[model samples]
Target: MRRRKDKHHANHERWLVSYADFITLLFAFFVVMYATSKADQRKQAEAAAAINSAFQSLGLFQSATPTKQLQGATDAGSAPAATQDETVTPMNVVMGDQMLASPQVQEDFERIKRHLEGLLSNQIARHVVALRIGREGLIISLREAGFFDSGSAVPHPSSLATLGQIAEALRTTPYDIRIEGHTDNVPIHTDLFDSNWELSTARATHLARIFIVGHQFAPARLSASGYAEYHPTASNETADGRAQNRRVDIIVLPRVTTPASPAVHVPAAKPAAIAAAIPAPTATAEATARPLP
Candidate 1:
């Protein structure tokens, strides 16, 4: 008889607990997916912008110096054709080749080539004599035998006029100049030059000193270094290539910043150095370190 009376049961909303958990997980999943998608978009944009900027900067880019010439001028070398456009591709630009042709730098390789043709003609033109002049400045190259003696970094008397001519031109140009000395695969051992490296450096310094003292180049802008058999424009396999490799190179670059204040040596080099040092981080740095960071 008691079974007929159904006890009043409490309404349990236990299903809401599971529903809330599922909703919470869904929200978190959506948040994570949104973050990942946003990050991917930003990264792709950044990469696209970088590629675009590099193309714009380099003179080789069609936009920088457009040429329908490349339209038909598929690479004769190992590089592939510009098969696609609108999408960025490595074929659009070659980093190594782009570096060689600096926008601010005018490779006088052509002008120097012409000059050599007029002067040394076929003899030197067949070799790797080069001239690189640009924002970094200018470098005129001559092979060891072309400008010096066997196993010697000393300049031949005949080459003095050539060097003098370069210095004279640069006197009014006002760009800082460095004479970099290079040598071939052969190791030079002599009393005057401890090794080929020293010989190359000394020769470069020798020319630099002359340019500064005689031609009135700012001493601050002049420097010299010798790289013996380290940097070669050509191969060392053949005698002709070796001759080309054993040479001097000049480098010129633009001044990105103002000349540093002349060092006033006091009892300590610290005060001036400290004054010249870059300012430390400010309050803005902490603000940048946030969840958004």
Candidate 2:
């Protein structure tokens, strides 16, 4: 009788199953590691792209391109000391120290100047706005004619782009934005828009909207108002002066630990030439304020 070889097999191969199981575990571990590594790489790329898009859109960071002569800016840490006393010195130098400090603020201004030169050149430079940094912060101004069409509330496309750049530069910058819209003395009456009051109001709102909505700037830090044909920078007596009268200002305030402006209604000052707050003038005075362009 075939003495059933009593299953002499000592089940020596049972260890093979254990070994196979161990191999599977090791393979799975490597796969997980590889997947995690790839995921991390993807996340980094996405973050870089987002930052690039943001900077480029704001004109704060440009692609590889040559800077133009009109562009009057120096690097942040490399600007020469301020030498032009003729240039208006910042006031209440308080905010300057707390946030940007004078040197950094000046650097920002230079950057802005260079950016503006790239976009607008000197044709509008005389009318171009100034970015003033002080203890209170930055004061950005836009001559009305350069920003809007006569008697209309719509923003010129160029103005919108410039404003976009400005917004980007101030992103996360802690400075509050004050949008001030001013109009000339001429009575504005268009079929679509009724009066300078309405037009000016619309313009201010439009600029504010770009920051609040387009750029997602904080609404709490932003405010807007219209000076309907009231805050004239030049005498309204002449076309040139009247033209100079219109403008928009974006004031960037410094970090204020306490209540600052007893009132937020400071009148827009006259041209840089006069260096004083002046009233709207008659048409004749406006004419004489500037020679024919």
Candidate 3:
């Protein structure tokens, strides 16, 4: 026999060492996955908390409980007086009282005015309607003859489309809208209405209903008032003046008091003057008011 080397033979079970290493590596991978999953959950919870905090700061909505911070997060103060060195004044509160009292809001109102003017250009040019920057943010004055019949609270059929357009334009705005009905000093007595007060109130209520029910405007943002003969843009001494007095005013109010600007007064023209200036259209049944017979 050849001389056999006495060197130690390699172990046949050495594959067990490789198998143990693989098991360890598999265990480590599962452990890492579990750790990563826990980290993801924590991050999601923190993100939700940050969103709630932001909403709270903006006064958007109420939360059920106070939000908790992440494990290592430090509280950061974003409020103006957190350090007590910043001077907060009463003017700040006053300014905050109105959401629309800012210069930016005023510019927005101007743009709206221009838009309205363009929309009602024909009526505006014919002097049947007037637009003014009043003590209120904006005033759109609609002549009675153009919208209603004499002593009637009902709007003319032709006026519906125009009123609908007006509602569409204003329903989306943030400003509060007040629809005011006014009548001439001349007393009105009809089966439907007792006096100017009743007539004006009915007219205002009618318009409000259209805005709320027809156009789906927010009831909270809309209001109706009847001034009767008390609040007139002109003296009700002449027929033209009376016609001017008999009008509806759509007032867009600012949320806060704005700086006063010079007001432009719109004068009322005489009925005869109006008729003479503008060609009279053919009399339509819709134009006639059902007056007391």
lDDT string, candidate 3, 1-293, tens digits: 99988998889999999999999999999999999999999888988777755654433232323455576676466332232222111111112223324565577678888988889898888888898865545788889999898877767767876776677788667666778888899988666676777777667767776676666665656668777888888988889999899999988765422213322323433333322343222223122122332
Clashing pairs in 3: 98-256
The estimated TM-scores of all candidates read 0.54, 0.46, 0.54
Best-to-worst ranking by lDDT: 3, 2, 1
Weakest 10 consecutive residues of candidate 3 by summed lDDT: 86-95
Q: In angstroms, what RMSD does candidate 1 have relative to the true structure?
A: 18.4
lDDT of 3 at 139: 82
User: Clashes in model 1: which pairs?
Assistant: 135-253, 135-254, 136-252, 136-253, 136-254, 137-252, 137-253, 139-250
lDDT of 1: 0.54
- Model 2 C-alpha lDDT versus the unseen true structure: 0.56
lDDT, candidate 3, equals: 0.67
- Each prediction's Cα lDDT score? 0.54, 0.56, 0.67
**With candidate 1 superimposed using the best TM-score fit, by how many Å does residue 282's alpha carbon deviate from the native?**
53
Tens-digit lDDT track for model 1 on 1-293?
56687799886998999999999999999999999999998777667656655654332232323322322336556563342312221112224433334343334334443454455444346553455443233456766766677765446656665665556555544344567787777876555555666767766766665565445565665667777777777798888788887787765433211234432322322223322332322323221111111
- What is the TM-score (0 to 1) of candidate 3? 0.54
Please write out the lDDT profile of model 2 over residues 1-293, one tens digit for every residue.
67765555567679999999999999999999999999998777667656654653332232232222122335556754433321112212232244334455556555654665555454356766654444334556677666666665666665666666667676546445667777788786656456566666666767776666566665656767777777676899998887766877776643221222222432322223111221222223211011112
Poorest 10 consecutive residues by lDDT, candidate 2: 284-293
